[model samples]
Target: MKLPYLPQDYSKKEHIIILSILLLFAFTAFLLTIISTTGSTSDYVPLTNIYLGTADITHINVTKVVPQIGPILAILGTALTAPNRTLDNIFDSLKTISETPALVPLMYLLSNAQNVSQSLISLTQLAPLAISGNPATDTKDLVEISGLLKVSSNESQTLNGLKNLVVPMLQSTNTSNKEDRTTELTLDLLADSKDPLTVAKSLTVLNNLTMEEKMKMIPIFTLFGVTKNITSLIGSLETIVSKGDAISPARSELMLTTLQTMLASNPNVTMAFGTISSLASGDDEKAAIGAIQTMLEDSNNVNTTLSSLSTLIKSNVTQAESSKTSLVALSSIIQNVNDQSKAVTTIAQLASNTDTATTTAQLSALTEMLKATEKGTETINILSQLQTSLNPNSTTFKYIPSLFTLLDASADPPVSFSSLVTLTAWAQQNPQTFIPIMGILSDALAVKMVSEDQLTEMTPTLLEYLRIPVYFQLSIFTLCKRNLEKDILECSASHAVQNLDFRQIIYDALSASEFAPYLNALNIGPNDLYLEGDLLNREHEYVPSIKAVLAMNILGIVFAFVVMINIGFLFWMKWSSKSYAWVIVIFLSSCTALFLGLSCTVLTVVLQVIKSGTYKDAFGVVFTTGVAYSAMMWCSFSLMVISSVVLLWVGITERHLRIPYLMKKNPATIEDLENSSTEADNAIQETKHEATPGQIIRHSTDNSSDFLKNDPDEKQDAVPDIQQTNTSDSS
Candidate 1:
């Protein structure tokens, strides 16, 4: 306790000394600042900033720093080179690990990690400067440089999101017989484990363990249980989540999964989900529930899991409503099949509660549960019962259109085009139920086009419904066809070309395929013959005017037939009686030339009319009328000309009374007639008694007799001389 210097002297000397030291410190500080101020600031922008009075200038804003600071840092770092021997040991161990063929990559990983670790130590060397000096950035840079060697997510973030060289392996939780010794060491440092070396040894034991050996570690985790290490695991979870690490989702998922599995086994991991759920609401709630639901859905303890879910649900009833609402499907999915009755009922209650949010997702989920009703009679019946409770329009059909959307996925069994078709089918099956959907479809059509696949998918359903009432088909045909255009345009870049086929298909389908049925049922035609002056009748005007142009051929034939009939009938009538027969003669003579002349004149007129230019309006009808009239005139003229010629010939022949005339055709010739006159000299007295003074004569008994009978024979010379005298006298 005795002091080498006396207390008072010691005090005075120390006080004076302390004052001198303080003064000296102030002086040197001033000198350094003055020197720095006098210097050029080509290298330091901050000095220029200080000169401008834009920033605070400082003493360490040195006019010059030792150019060798880089080597100085190296040399200073070497003074603690023995302390850094741990890094060497680490490097050598890493080298050994590297050269160890099997662990080489991991060794390189560790080597880089060692560099990062060394850099961290180097940053420690810069700590005083970082903490107490304006060069804090430099210190921070050193820290960052250490971290940049690539490792850890938090370290990554800290080190400008520094990566672990073997990041996937590094962040990965190893649970093998030969465990990740690095991870074990990290845990030892991180966890404050009771025996870090033992824990370290345990990590080595894990690494050497085969997959089978790794299996042995399960009980260890199982025994340690999730609850035992909940805090640490959650911390890691929180770290990953907070850092928003690139693999956060995956990492968090794994962490959560592990927590869930461990908790499910021990019935304790529910805490984490519970913790997460409490902070979340709405979409967040569903997510938390989803996390736990995945775990609980598979647990052997169905009751426990459901109870946990129910418990989780109760914590935030809104969340429970949400989770239950969401998990209803997932519940059905992963929940024990045996517990489905209970689960489904729970799901039904959640679904039925109108108080719950009707978000599209909620609506979708509720609809989906109804869709998934394939398993049990009880489940299906319950769903059916629940369906009855909601508004037919507001609750069920309100979302039937979404079912059509789900068709896009075209999942097998449930998600096929047929599934979408089924919705349409259901709409058709119960038209009243899905009428709104048609309207929705209409609106949808108005926005973007539908695809033909979608149309084809729904065609049967639409057709089936439309077939019931013809009015529906006719009215909806335009819609169906137009929407089909929309359908085709869905994929095409060119809207113009898109629906061309659709127009043809739909137009043809209704216009042609359904033409008869549609027209018949509606009692409509292009011209309404049956609509005779009904109230809706536009106007009624009836005038008997032949469509002469169209009917020209018909009219001509008809007139010709009439003329022929009149002629034939009159001829027959006249032949039956002489009084009528005279009528026939007069009729034929008067009408024949007139009809023929009229037809010829009409023909000429029509030919002239047809030769002119096209009809301005009525020329066609006028021309056709002219043609028909001309045809009638010509036909009459032709018949009359032939008839007149025949009658005149008959009269002339009838006036002649010679033998040839009796025959009227011929009696060989007139010479024969003259010879017959000589022969008649014998029979003339006997046969001269023909009626109307008609004469009959034989030409001769024989050819020679006719010549000789008129001439004198040699023995009849005397008779001939008398005959010659009589002949001369007669001449």
Candidate 2:
């Protein structure tokens, strides 16, 4: 009955304790399952509720089936814990097991579950400051807003003074003229200004215009117009302000006179002479003429000369005798300059062709002369004298109108001068006087200075700028984008400027700022959320939204599968009988499974608690969730504790204090048993020969009792053992 080498503690007591614990765990888990199934219709416990074609089999429940899962697993795991195989070997086998058809699918399930949980957390956290509660709605609004800004930015610059003013002027409503509405809105924005009340006074002059006055307003507001005497002029003074120019009293007076003179002289001007005449007094007209004369006489009047040439070019020369006469005189002067080297040709090419290359070269020459001359006034005087020379009758004029009949043959400007090479050569050789004069003339046109009329026209255009909503919304989008790009508080900076309140940009324009007057005039207010701020605030919902609930469910299933895999692996190891450290592996593995399963299940219930907010419902959910968690935890814990105790019993009971069946040789074979029987027989014979019959009987009974104690199944063979024990030798 005795084995050659058995683990000391391998016994019925040890097996009984382990099996008892597994039975208790299985029973408790089954009880919980029943309670959960019957308690509430809404409650859906994961492992217990797995439905497969309505078999309704209780044994199929993985959690309750301890004999197949936990005990078998522990046994296999215990056998696997030999001194040869290690935990690392177990882990390697686990990785290999992951390739199994059943387990591989669980990996993806677990991964997806984790993603759902994390994504729900992010959404709830970001929902607070988002433009709308619905993410799709907010995203649509953002796209629309982006489109609006794109169009506004492109179109905002194209609106000139005249175009900006004309639309509002023609827009008449039942309540007020659209122009007046625009002005009123602008006025309200300026209502809280710390400065003097100039806004109302300025708008009053515009609002007082009659129908005829409004008609007159049209022609005088063009930006650049070609004329008879004045070649090019800005139609309005308002452009000066819009372009951010400084306008002193002297500059203002000079602008006003210059505008009047230019308008009166421009034969191609659309405005009537009488209207142009009416805009300036007789004295103002004379002063303007004097200012033009003085500016010309000072030798810095290339501006005036170019203006005259542009006007002559634009004139109705084909129809008007006066324009033809001026052109004739201009041609004669150009011919006179040609006598002074090929410089005149460069000048002619610059003026007629308006070639950028020729113009740039000429301008560069003038810039050099100005730099060399150092005294800007002296350079201006020199250029002004050159300009005067263009006027054939001036005392400062160098070229006089000649009596050459051949010159009049080409009344119109020349079409072509020289080739690209020759023109460049001409510009290079004639760098001194001719090039500088041409340069000065070209420089004069580049700045595009506005006239007083243009300056006055900008008032209405600016008012329109204030009324447009995209103007501010675009600014907010830009600010937020910047803040996002930089990851900083760029939006918090104040941007107010120049009686305009140009700064302090935000997401929703109507709701923010001191520009409430404009909002009121347009009938938008704090209640109107037309402009939405699409920022995500820090606050999140206590419970993740409905989306989160779905995520939790997915994760729970994943956790359940994970726990099952570990239990399955444990059973495989136990069945293999290769492991000596099964007790520790079972204990640790069960704890890990318990932790994963219980944590995820409890988290699902926690999410529900966050949603309902009612303590009554919360308590019920919490209780159910707790019970489920406890059952799983207890199942794993009991498996681990009982499995470890059984292994320890084996360790304590074994004589060799090592695993049973580890040694290669077996000492309990037939040949070894026969030899042991012969030795027993000889020892018995010696005892019979030396001892009395009573001692022999006593000794034989003692030997039989010892043998029976060792082998419980051999109790029936005890009488035969005494009868065959050499009684004749003892007698």
C-alpha RMSD (angstroms) for model 2: 32.6
Q: Candidate 1, residues 290-332: lDDT per residue as tens digits?
A: 5444444344553444443333223332222222232232222
**Candidate of highest lDDT:** 2
In angstroms, give how far residue 290 of model 2 lies from its true place: 24
How high is the CA lDDT of each candidate model? Answer: 0.29, 0.30
lDDT for 608 (candidate 1): 41
lDDT of 1 at 332: 24
- Candidate 2, residues 1-731, lDDT tens digits: the string is 22212222234454445445544443443343333222222123343221100111111111122111222122223323334433344334433433333222222211122222222222222223122234343233222222322333222221121122222222222235222223223222222222212322222233333434333333221111222222212211122212212223344344445554765576333343335445544554534334333323332333544354233223322233332332333333323331212322222232332223322333333333333332433333333333323332432111112101111221111110011112223323333322322222223223333332343333223222323122211110022111111222222232221011112222143234223432332243333322111111101332233234224333433433443343344333233233344444344434533543453454454434432332232111111123443454345435434544544454344233222232213323324333445565666678778887566232233323333345443222111122222233234
Q: What is the lDDT of residue 257 in candidate 1?
A: 49
Stretches of candidate 2 above 4 Å error?
Answer: 1-14, 26-39, 42-660, 665-731
